[model samples]
Target: MSTPPASAGTGIAASRWRHLPVGALETVRGNLEDALLAGLLALPVTFAAAVLGGLVGEELMEPSGPATTLDLTSRASLAAVAVLAVLGVLARGLVIALRGVLMARALAAAVRAGTPPTEVPAPLQWQHAHERSDRAYRRTAIILLVILGLCFGVVVPAAVQEPFLSGLAIIVAGAAVLGLIALGIPLTGTVLRRRQLALLGPVDGHWTQAHRIIAAGHVLTGDAVAAARAGRPERGHPGSAARRLGKVATAVVGVGATAAYLGFQVVAALAFPDRQRWAGGLPGERADLGPEAERMVDLAVTVCVVGGAVAILALVVGALAGLAERTQEQAALRRALVEGAAPPPYPVLQRYLRRRSAPLLRMVSALVGVMLVVGGTLVVLDGVVDAPSWGSFAGAGQGLREATGLGPGILGLALGVAALEVALASLLEARERRLRDAVVQRWPVRPAPGG
Candidate 1:
């Protein structure tokens, strides 16, 4: 074999090194943007929860006493709820609209980059896949509805008075439902694959419309990355100014609501409750304010806590979305390099390898770190501080039990569940890496001179 020129080899190596950092930085920036967007989208949920908490707080502090039914007849309460509801709905709508705008921009960028159209499977095969997907969805929905009805409508209502029992029931039911869904996913995928193979003949490997769509998405994403790196500006659509204004307005509402919620929590904790009423008594045991005041306080605190939990969940989802995006990019680059097809830019390839080697390990490590930090913090706080009867932390456990029937045991259960998830994810990640390595090794690399 003839040796390539030294200059050519040097040029290739230089090109590979030149944009590697830029590409990786771009990937990280994209992930952060995705996470922030996801968190923004969840603001409405948090706002709604805050509003509910506020209403509950008002009822607790009401002069007439807590009503069995919400007093929607009260003008002040009704107006406040209505206003908050409208704001939440508007915020949600704007977020969705902004998402659409971003998607349009992405599509335009993909088109400008000359990304190829997605491949379409044969009509019969497509139809079969569609039918199978629909059937699976419907079946899953029905099972979910049945399980929810049994748990919430029957079991939960029966144990409503017993907070611990009801909370445990909810947790158990939720876990079982999640496990069922998880198991069903793989079984469904297997069935779909077998059916496809039977129809397309065993010689034809697994291919489906979903796979085609995913492949197309990867291509578009790759093109977008390339265009971004090349400094090509994405053309704005008509009404861009209006969309920008809408986004601004929505953001204002979301931020204002979130701040207001936090303020309420602070004020309610420090100034609202009468600490003297419950002095020398266990939290929620004294009826100094009213018979139902302590109960209402617990309910309000529970709602706020739940809202905080939801916010955290939203951020987690955003992080996952970013991870998924990076994974797709890595896969696209790997396949291209291995197949000797149109390989991505050298920088992108370098970026992929830099990311791919240790994502799962990093994720697992992060999870463990978080677990340790949280556990240690809780242990330290429990030992160092004696909780006041009227303090914010006071009656928190009772509040949780009142609201969800969950006791302190729920904390341990949550940690256990998280640990299990980390373990499972690590195993799956390892298996995936092994499979990808096998494929890469099997195929001879065909280097493309340029991206």
Candidate 2:
């Protein structure tokens, strides 16, 4: 083997290193004003949130009666709150910063493509689009990770220790966050898909070209196209005997799982003693688990209910996505056959659906991860901290230890949240793999090329 000259080798290595920072520098250069604004906005918010948190923590950790002076434990507790507040504010800042950067890049791309600012960016080649999409996916994921870290490490844990009314208030805040995430993820996905489709506009007029684009984009199978062309049934379609059976099996499995989970929920509810007079019947007639136990049960039920709701929502989304996919695939095949491989101008509806073939599971996973972090942190903090009055954080640590038996401890909450995230991630990943494999398997068994 011959080695390259030293100058040539050095130049190559140096070029690669130089390119590494170009993207970042470009982003910063494009969004310099927004970046500065983000920095400016972040400081005050961070300081305000942290200082407020510290003050709140000081009040919580104050002695039972009148206490003018702070103790060591109290000071430490205040510091924890301050740290969490800083994290939350910083997370928000990061979101602002990242959004600014994305917007700037998108604007630049649009200009380069000569598309109107109001209209979406034209879709790039599928390969290029896919690469950019992967990068976007990773960036979006990092933003979500930051949100989760803030929620789990700061907001929920810090806020949930308030009085009953305040606790409810914070829980509502957490729910609002979840709602935002659910809405945001789907909206982002729709925008991305629309942009991709817009990019494919030039090829829209030709059916043959569009067919190849769709196939190359992994939107439809060649076999499906062939079957459609010949006016025959597409093999392995849902209408097929095996697929129909599979559908039935899937429904049965889903129903069984739902029933089992419902049963478990019922059993859990019954197992917990009813303490409130309104809940059971008469005051003395209802058995009361100590106040702590009751609170713990309430927290557990809330977590379970929220988790269940998320699962149901995910299933609904998955079902809708699957239906949409099948419809699009059939429509693409139909258009291809009917048009006789006409050049360009693919059906707009079919093209839209085809371009959006990427799974929503990953985005949904990120949303769920954020929700779990917030919910789990809230539940754990509620169990551990008892902020009866202004300053009561000093005793919270002790309360946390005692409440361990009543509620799922901090460790258990963390573990449960982690497990849920893992399960959802694994399920989605497997689904994506199966889908890719099925598409790959759809290649024609025998080629009629150059015929």
Candidate 3:
């Protein structure tokens, strides 16, 4: 093999060895800050999980009837909730840990990119960076805590007391929180930028370029790290194939389970009219659904089933596509490394960072979509089946309320709230991606010499 150039070796040595301590320290500080933020972000989820777990636990332990045995559907619901609660707890911790690792890699790559080949960054420079990051993290955590406290402590409790208004209150509270976060991002970035300029004397475009290089390095490193963690198949690695197969199997199982649950609900609804009470209808009363109403119900159920299947299929396809993209990203990273060139700009990295809990977010979105479909279907059925019997607008309204009760009403409200959340998230993500792309273009990374 031909010997590498002296400058190339020196740069590698400096980044890998001489400046390793600075990078390591920065990584630790960043991870600590991120951990705090993660914990704060998890508070609402933890609360929800705890409440769900408690409810499910109580239901499971209580006697269902004279035989003390629960029906399969009741048992399934309780079990599913319990499992979700446990998974939520586990997923929280796993995400935090993964974020820590990602931060470590990003910080290391950033330190390497920011530091010149001839000089390691001064300890004071690292200290300044740490302070800026710490301040941002602390402010975010404080704001999140305050928002969560207010929503859960005051808003939720007050709303719960009013049976008629609780759903509305929950929706409003959720939207308010998402809106606040959306507003906070740009505001926080502006404040931090000003703070940076104040702390470090105004400099030429080089300073801005260096910051951009560091950011690009972070993004590239994060992509590489995430791709590596994805466990793509490697040549001569038989076990990698098995792992990839296992991942596919897991996805398939998840889709199947969701389909099974939805199918069970539909079958029960059609077969056991008395059990409609569980879905907020009156017990022991026949819906007396006419042929037209029955056809509508069938159509609604079929739509729900098909909609759910499509959602799951979309999720699976997305996952597979992501896996393939990650594999390509890894190859690109390797090529960039070998050729000493900057990787192509990847705007998705910005979106990925913003959506750290993407899997969870997607799941929730799917669930909300399902809820909307089911709830709307029930509302339509109520108006169709009962409105004719009641024979007047006022009577129809009362009949609709009595038939659907609080269940579908809450689901409908939740769907509305979720729509707001999705809109806000998309807007913020697009803005962030644009900002990141602008930064990358303005301060493009320089290619290394002697590639």
Candidate 4:
């Protein structure tokens, strides 16, 4: 081996990083701070929703019941709901923390294996794959947040005792707040990604050196590389219009189903015998109704069932399409890397790492599907079975119990799904980072520092 360079401090600097924690704590702290900021921004909207719910419940539903029963049921239901919410938050946090821990451990192992540290990007020199699917990811996230927020704002108030005008006002206000939040999410994510990439730094050398360095670092598992090798990347074709159209059908169906449901609600409200009656309503009980009212309710029940089914179907299909897209992207990246530089010939003994979060996406989808189905079933049963009024706290509690028992809490499922999507996005980001480092290392050309 050649003698070490003079100025020997460089050796010490490298050795220090060899034992470093690889910025795991920094990553978690940054993520938590971003999450806190997001929560703070959303706090006002959540508080407003809770206040409005309590006000409407006390004014209308409570007055219809014995005070003691109402108080007991309300408190019991709220407590149960709070407990479930806390559990869900804890579960999600645990998942994220565990993932970070594992990554840190792997990185530490890489350091111990003698992987050399790359030069970090100066603050102004940083560049990442923001131009890639990240833009689309952010946009889609924002759109989904806006759509769901509007739906909840409109639907929840209508479900309670809020007047039509009051519900409309809530929807407008919620949309405005969520719009700001939508913008914030992606910006925060971009900053975090940039910081992480800067810390990881760029590997620099020839293509062969790049490959060796990555292998030494263990940035990707062997199975991922092997799978990429076995799979053929999808190629664009002149006659692929039909396939492209098919891919988008899921989103279209989801949008259509949601629109149909909203339309049905509007039509039923307009056609009702007295619109004002809904403003102060009991869930299962109605005044002596004529045949027309009965028929309208039946029609609504039918629409809800069909619409919910379609929406769930759409989400399932969309999720599958997403997986396919990821697979294709991985194939393409793998092909590019292999063509540029060959990996080690010897087989690795490490167990294959399956994408754990992949199955979670399906689970969340199922939970959401079940929630929709249960809600539709309840409405249909109410229409056909002549049940007692469900507007009371006890009835509401019973409904909550049924819903929670059947599927995970709707809020929890939604949160889980969002987290999974974010995780998947991070995967794509990891791949991009590796590719960027490889390219820069091979070419020996760096982007000039700029803000």
Which regions of candidate 2 are displaced past 4 Å? 1-108, 114-250, 265-270, 273-451
Instruction: After superposing candidate 4 on the true structure, give the runs of residues whose Cα lies further than 4 Å from its correct spot.
Output: 1-22, 25-234, 237-247, 270-289, 341-436, 439-451
- Displacement of residue 312 (Cα, Å) in model 3 is 1.1
Report how far off residue 8 is in candidate 3 (Å): 8.7
- Each model's TM-score? 0.29, 0.28, 0.31, 0.37
lDDT per residue for candidate 2 within 397-442, as digits (tens), equals 4544343343335435533643454455344433433332222223
lDDT, candidate 4, 1-451, per-residue tens: 1112212343323221011232334234323323323333233222222332332343324453344333333333333333333333333333333332333333534445566443322111111211222343354455556665666666765645677778668777766756654664555456544543442333222112433343334233445545544545434422234335446766676675675466446434634434455533423323465677656555554554455556556545665655554445445435544565333111211100112123233434345333333333333333423235434434344444343343334445545654554455345444444444443232222233221
lDDT of 3 at 15: 31
Instruction: Identify the runs in model 3 with alpha carbons over 4 angstroms from their true place.
Output: 1-75, 90-286, 346-451
Candidate 3: the clashing residue pairs are none
Local error of candidate 2 at residue 171 (angstroms): 15
For candidate 3, the per-residue lDDT at 364 reads: 48
Work out candidate 1's RMSD over C-alphas.
Answer: 20.0
lDDT scores in order: 0.39, 0.38, 0.40, 0.40
Error of 2 at 357 (Å): 7.0
Steric clashes per prediction: 2, 23, 0, 0
Worst 10 residues of 1 by lDDT: 14-23
